[model samples]
Each structure stands twice: as C-alpha cells, then as structure tokens.
Target: MGTKIPISVLVVIHTPDLRVLLLERADHPGFWQSVTGSVDGADEPLAETCRREVLEETGIDSAAHVLTDWQLQNRYEIYPHWRHRYPEGVTHNVEHVFGLMVPDAVPVTLAPREHLAFAWLPWQEAAGRCFSWSNAEAIRSLPARAAAW
Candidate 1:
C-alpha cells in the first residue's frame, strides 16, 4: 500500500439551524465525528479533497452545499491503533477544517466500510460526542466560525 499522507480534511456538515451531522466510525462503532478523509494524493488540493470525501463517505454533493474552508488545521498524533496506515516513523497528521452547510438535517448514506450510521445533532451535543479531541474541538468552534461568516 502507498504511504498514507499526513494530511486530511475534516468537514463539519451542518445546517444554518445548527444541526450537525455525525457519522459513526465503522471500526470504532460508537466513535462519531464529522465527515473526514485523507487527501488522495499531492495532486489534489485540500478543498477538492474535502468535497470528494464528503461525497464518497456520505453521498453529500459538496458542490450543492455551501462548503467553507475554515482556514484551520489540527496537528495531532496518529491514534495508536491506526498508525499502521501511515509510513514507518510517521507520528502525526495535519487535519484541515471545512464546513458544509445544508438547508436542514437530512438522511445520509454512510459508506459501509468507513462508517456505519449517521445522526444530526445539536452542535453542543455533537461536539461532546466526537471521539477525537480535534474533531470535538472543531465542532466546539463551529458557532464562532459560523458567526464570522
């Protein structure tokens, strides 16, 4: 397998009403977070990667939604169990932030191998439920970020 890139995109899918979308990780059933995926290759810009990941993982057409690049990034250690996906000696990843604003909470088709189910929850509750500290941090910052827009 190719070396996993140390960069990723985390897209917080939410509506103007503050309903946030959360997807349960397939590998860790109860662990939930926003839409996320690694950048496919160096050739793809991060914004494109965000759009692609949202569509691939949740069947959400990013172009149709308002996808905002939040201009934020989180550098975190790779989870021990997931370190195998990275190249030897790689220890950290940089996850860029984005947000997809839909009109309302809607059903999503989770990619079976990556995610099991989905829910739309209030931002405060969603922030508290995310498994990753960085993911939770993003959700927690959403209100302020949205306000800036």
Candidate 2:
C-alpha cells in the first residue's frame, strides 16, 4: 500500500449564502468534516489536491465552482487511529486551507469508503459539527472571508 504524505488539503465547500457542506467519515462514524485528503505525491500541486479531494469525496467538480485558496495553513497532530496511513514517526500533518463556493446547496455523492453521509448546514452549526478544530475554524471564518471576496 502506498503511504500518505504528511501534507494535506482541507477544502471547505459552501454555498453563496454561507451554508457549509460537511461529510461524515465512514472510518469514524458521526465524525463530520470538510472535504480533506492527503497529497497524492510529493509533486502534486495543493490546488489540484483540493480539487481532486472535493471531486473524489463529494462528486463536485470544484473547477465549475469558485474555488479559492485561503492561504492558510494549520499544523496538527495526527489522530492515533489514522496515523498508520503515514510512515512511521509521522505524528503531525500540515493542512492547507481552501474554499469552494457553489451557487447553491447542491447534492453530493459521497464516497462509500471515505464518507457515509453529508449535510449542508448553516455556517455556525457546521462549525460546531465539524470533528476537526481546523475545519471548524475555517468554517467559522467563512462569513468574514466571503465578505472580503
């Protein structure tokens, strides 16, 4: 099996009105988060990683929407259960933040192996529902960030 990289992308998919799309992880049921995935290779561009993850997990072609790199990065410890996906001694990950703005709350086709369910919630509730602090923080910043866009 191929090892995952320590770098990943967290793409917060949302609608114009600040509704955020969150996915329930299949591996950890009830744990919801934004579209996230590790870089496929050392050379993969972060933007492409974001687009690929959004498409793979939500069946949303992010290119058709307004996908923006927020220029934010967070370093967090890897969850013990998921650490096996990386190489030994890889205990932390650097996650880049991104946002994808859709015209409306569209239906998503979740990947069975990665996600079990999905929801479109108001930004505040979405932030509360997210299992990751970085994901929640990103969602909470949407209103201000969207205003500046």
Candidate 3:
C-alpha cells in the first residue's frame, strides 16, 4: 500500500435541518466521525477527495447534493495508532473541511470494511458523540454554516 498523504479532507454530511451523519469506525467500534480520507495522490483536488470519501464511506453520491466547501481547515497530531498509515516521521495531518447538504436525513449504505454503523443526529448531539475534536467543531459550526447557505 502507498503511504498516506498527510493532507486530507473532512466532509460533514448533513441535512438542511442540521441533522449530521456520522459513521462508526469498523476498527474502533465506538469511535464515530464524519467522512474523512486523504487525497488519492499529491495531484488530487481536495474537493474530489471529499466527494470520493463521502461516496466511499456512506454510499451517498455527493454530486447529487449540494456540496459546499466551508473553507475551513485544521491541523492535528495523528493518533499514534494510525501513524503507520502515513510516511515515516509524519506526525500530523492537515484537513480541509467541507459540507454536504441533503434535503433531509437520508438513508445511507455504509461500507462494511470501513464503517460498522451510521446515524443521523441533531447537530448538537452529533457533535457530542464525535471522538475527534475537529469533527465535533465542524458539526458545532453547522448552525452558522447552514444559516448562511
């Protein structure tokens, strides 16, 4: 497998009413998060990475919905356990944030290998359930972000 790039995208999938979709990591049962993945290659666009991860993780075609680049980014230390996925000595990842707005809480088809379950919850509740601070912050911003859209 190729070493993962430290640059990634975090796509917060939600509904117009502020219900956020979160996925349970198959490898870490209780750890839930939004759709996240590194770019396929150095040349891949962040927007394309967001679209690919959204569809790959939730089986939701981002092209069919309103996908908005929130222009937010976060840099955080990579969890020790996941460091092996990246290049040697890499310690952090820079994540670009995006939001996908569906009309309502839509059913999702989770990729069994990557995710075990999925839920659509109110933004506040969803934020509380997220394991990653960055993910939670993004969900918390939904009210303001949705308001502007």
Candidate 4:
C-alpha cells in the first residue's frame, strides 16, 4: 500500500435525535469508530474528503444529509500498530472533524475490507464504544454541537 497522508477527517454520522453510527474495523474486530479516511491528495478539500469517506466506508452519501464542518480539529498520536501505513517518522495525525446528520438512524452498507459490521447507538453509548479517543471525544460533543446546528 502507498503511504497515507498524516492528515485525515473524522466524521461523526448521526441522526437528528443524536443516535450515532459506529463501524467495527475489519483489521481489529472489536474496535469501532466513526467514518474516517485520509485526504486523497494535497489539493483535495477537507469537506470533499469527509463526504468521500462517509460514502466509501458506510455507503452513506454525506451530501444528501446535513453535513457540517464543525471546524474542530484534533492532533493525536498514531497508534503504534497502524503507524506503518504512513511515511516513516510520522508518529502523529491531524484530524478534521465533521458532522453528518441524517433524518433518522438508517441502514448502512459496510465496506467489507475496511469494516466488518456496523451499529447505530445512542451518542453516549457510541462515544463509550469508540476505539479512538478523538472519535469518542467528537461523539461526546454531539449534543452541544447539534444544538448549535
């Protein structure tokens, strides 16, 4: 695989009622997270990256929903086990946050190679189940964030 960019998007897909969608990683059976992926190229817009990831990972077209760039960003260390996907010496990542609000909790088609299963749960429970701290933190912010939307 080619080296991935150290910058990425973390999209919290949720319903108007605050139910969040979580996908279980194929590489790590029980590890769950929101829709995420690196920017395809340096020139790609972050909003496009966010929409692309949501569609690619969960088959949900973010453009059809109320996709909002929360303008929140988090810098976090790349997990040791997954660091090899990036260039050598890349130990951290910058994640841009976004929120995709659908009308309700709906079915999702998981990209089998990237995710094994999926679930829609209350935002609090979804936050608790996320494997990444940033993902969890984003989920935890859903209520307040949605309120401002």
Alpha-carbon TM-score of each model against the true structure: 0.95, 0.96, 0.97, 0.95
Question: Candidate 2: which pairs clash?
Answer: none
lDDT (tens digit, per residue) of candidate 4 on 45-64: 99999988898998888778
Tell me the lDDT of candidate 4.
0.91
Could you give candidate 3's per-residue lDDT for residues 18-128 as a string of tens digits?
999999999999999999999999999998998899988988988999988899999999988889998899999999999999998877999999999999999999999
Poorest stretch of ten by lDDT in candidate 1: 1-10
Number of clashing pairs per prediction, in order: 0, 0, 0, 0
Q: Report the CA-based lDDT of candidate 1 relative to the real structure.
A: 0.90
- TM-score, cand. 3: 0.97
The best candidate in terms of lDDT:
2
lDDT of 1 at 59: 91
lDDT of each: 0.90, 0.93, 0.92, 0.91
In model 4, the runs with Cα more than 4 Å from the true position are: none
Clashes in model 1: which pairs?
Answer: none
Q: Candidate 2: what lDDT?
A: 0.93
Model 3 misplaced stretches (Cα beyond 4 Å): none
